[model samples]
Target: MTADSLPPWLRQPLAELLRQRGHAWLLQGPSGLGQYELGLALAAAWLCEQPEEAKAQGACGHCPSCHAIQVRTHADLCVLMPEVAMQALGWPLDEKSQADIDDKKRKPSREIRVEAMRDAIGFAQRTSARGRGKAVLIYPAERMNNITANALLKTLEEPVGEVRFVLASEAAWQLLPTIRSRCLGFTLPWPDSGQAQDWLVGQGVPAADAPGLLRAAGGRPSDALRLASQGQSPKAWSLLPKAMSRGEVGALSEHAPAQAIGALQKLCHDLMAVDCGALPRFFEPADLPPAPPRAALARWSRSLASAAKTAEHPFNAGLMLEALVSEARTTLNSASRRP
Candidate 1:
């Protein structure tokens, strides 16, 4: 998407980033803040064929380079992402990798593989294909394992030819210090509540649902939009805390293990917040059941944290949801039974 279509909160940062001079940049922040969008915009601007004056506004939407990126076939741009993410975002995989997965010889990887990093390094050393310099855009850069990160280190530190690099990450702390040391770092800005709600409504979220979805996302506009796109109504989210308190498995039955765990964590967080004399962040105070005892909430919080680590590969998703809801019910009921 063109920078013009980016969320209002990102426009200023996009223009600011376009004006800066850096061969390698690291766009970092928590999830749902638009690190990937900003990184892509910066890369597009660098490779755009527009006149310098026009380029200053971000990539001119009509240029061949911009078109190529829009179609995920830009010869001068190399995107380094996990195979799963690449497919999800419409980027074509190299023939060999695609063939292997299609042939059922291997599964799409969740982490950036070392082999892909080597190919990207080779791309960096090659001559620019479209006259303009080439760029390597790596999203969720923390997905690179130690070996893969090392493969990129030398190229990142001392680039070949006119190539530039942009690594976007939701968790920058997980990156190697050397990798962090080599690139200019930019933290994505958090949009104000009003801006976030407005953007959500603009993205087709019903205006009435915007505030609740925004709250559910903890004020991350992109995340709120994602929840809307997933068919999660504001009313459904508001009812979740009470549903979990009632030990209702169907409330989270459709969610993946990881998602259910995340929803539960938010509930635990809000309950703890109310217990500590603060407002709930994810749910309205009236929507939430009475605060659980601090000790019981603390135990549940730890349990959810432990569950999250294994949520991605649960042995049985059904059993996991049942257990999680059961724990939530017990913890949520503890305060009411207090003498």
Candidate 2:
């Protein structure tokens, strides 16, 4: 879906700023959080030939170029995704042709590739298609390796025309410091869990259980809405509470890291709220698992938060899983012992 269609919380802040100030930008956010969609939206707004105010106000959504750009067919707007170079071999994917390339094993090309960057740079060097603005969008901008990144850097540092670069990335931290420093970025906040649950229900998640689905989806409305739309979320929701109470260390390690952490993150949120006496809850008070004995909850919360901070490390997965499970076991055991 296009970023324009996304809820306001999910829209990029820099897109709004660019409209106000007339500038280029970099967009960064978590994976599956729609950074690329935001980039495309920014490009469409930049390239529309209508009055600058109309173009900047919003993609007219009805303009011919807006329609084409929305669907990614605009001639002047360039989009560079990772290149799947099947032609280098004797095989390529086609609608009628079957190939042995394992789709599941496919990875984003290690880099956007120097050739694609060069072409985009060259396109930007030319005059605009409508004698106004030209736009180049690069996805996972951080994926541009040293050579490709350097080539793009030269153009960005000294562009020859009324060109704008809108780059998108899930891992902005991987970008060269120089490149990142030059670009303005918008940090999109994940929607709060209740808003996410409401969004899931709106997408046809059963009203009775959307909260659990929101928790399992990591409080990201887009994530929650997608699971509900596909009917895959209920099963995950069903598994989550049980996992919280009993899905020990070994089981957590075996399950998806994101799935396990998602549920645990919800539990942490719930516990924090309960400790602070927050009212108007998403979790049912009766169904709510009790927080750990006061001291243990504090200790476990610190450990889990620490693990969360280190979760990106290669070695942290096993340790984090064990820590979560141990914490869960402690909470459950303490609950049972209480009067």
Candidate 3:
């Protein structure tokens, strides 16, 4: 959706805050839930001298600043993303693929490195590129490691005249408490199930597949739509039931690539959400091909939690997926055996 069509709850308050003329905001939400979009819109509004409504929301879509923000080429707006030095080499990147191609063409580090944070700080401190206030959007803000966070502390503490920092993160709690407290928190709401499902169907997903996508996404429409776009192979889903039900961790490795791990995580998450009385209507049965049973659900809940814990400690992608799959299969098997 265009920035203007952003939900009223977020747009109105943000519009009011920007109108006040000197405020920085932290928008926290699930990834792909419109935090970045709001940030860019706000940046455009800040730079736009003549907004369409003649109010705080001044970045009219027709204006040059709005267009630049939409295209992510604004002169004064600095976007700090994970650096990709090796994109030139054009290595066929895949999951578990983490080797730097070469010194000159090294792929970007998985984690946001300290150097990225430093560059962002440098840009923010420089004179505004367009004589307007400098705007910074640090995506996945928690990606900044401890050293980078420390480096950022100096800038966050002081008021850089005419400069605004917008930090967007899926997991804001991972950030240092001091940094989090410094900025205004804007918690974004996920779209309703209807909106999410409609968005998915509009994107060429068959109506039958919409249910699985919706359930998998937990009513988060954008996420469901994105996963649908990737066209995850059916083998991954086919193996999922058996893995979780029988503790057959190997079942997962047979069919799933590391890329599918994230989707698997969401699937288990959906199972947990559903078991807890929250029906995530976004996932369509056809898209994800759901297999639901009470016993299976309980097993999935127990196994997925344990697997998540293990995955966090060593970051073993294979082990994690296997554990998740095994737990889910065991759960389903138990359900079938139940009298």
Separately for all candidates shown, the number of backbone clashes (residues 3 or more apart, or on different chains) is 0, 0, 33
Error of 2 at 68 (Å): 1.4
* Runs in model 3 lying further than 4 Å from the true structure: 5-17, 20-22, 49-55, 84-105, 202-208, 232-327, 334-339
* Quality of model 1 by C-alpha lDDT: 0.91
Candidate 2 residues 42-128, lDDT tens each? 777777767775544456677777777645567677776664422322222232222323454444354576876788788888877
After superposition, which runs of candidate 1 have C-alpha atoms over 4 Å from their true positions?
337-339
| Root-mean-square deviation per candidate | 1.4, 6.9, 6.2
Best by TM-score: 1
In model 1, which residue pairs have backbone atoms overlapping below 3 Å?
A: none
Top model number, lDDT = 1
Q: Between the candidate structures 1 and 3, which one is better when assessed by lDDT?
A: 1
TM-score of 2: 0.63
Better of 2 and 3 by lDDT: 2
lDDT of 2 at 200: 62
In order, the Cα lDDT scores of the candidates are 0.91, 0.64, 0.62
Better of 2 and 3 by TM-score: 3
- TM-score between model 3 and native: 0.71
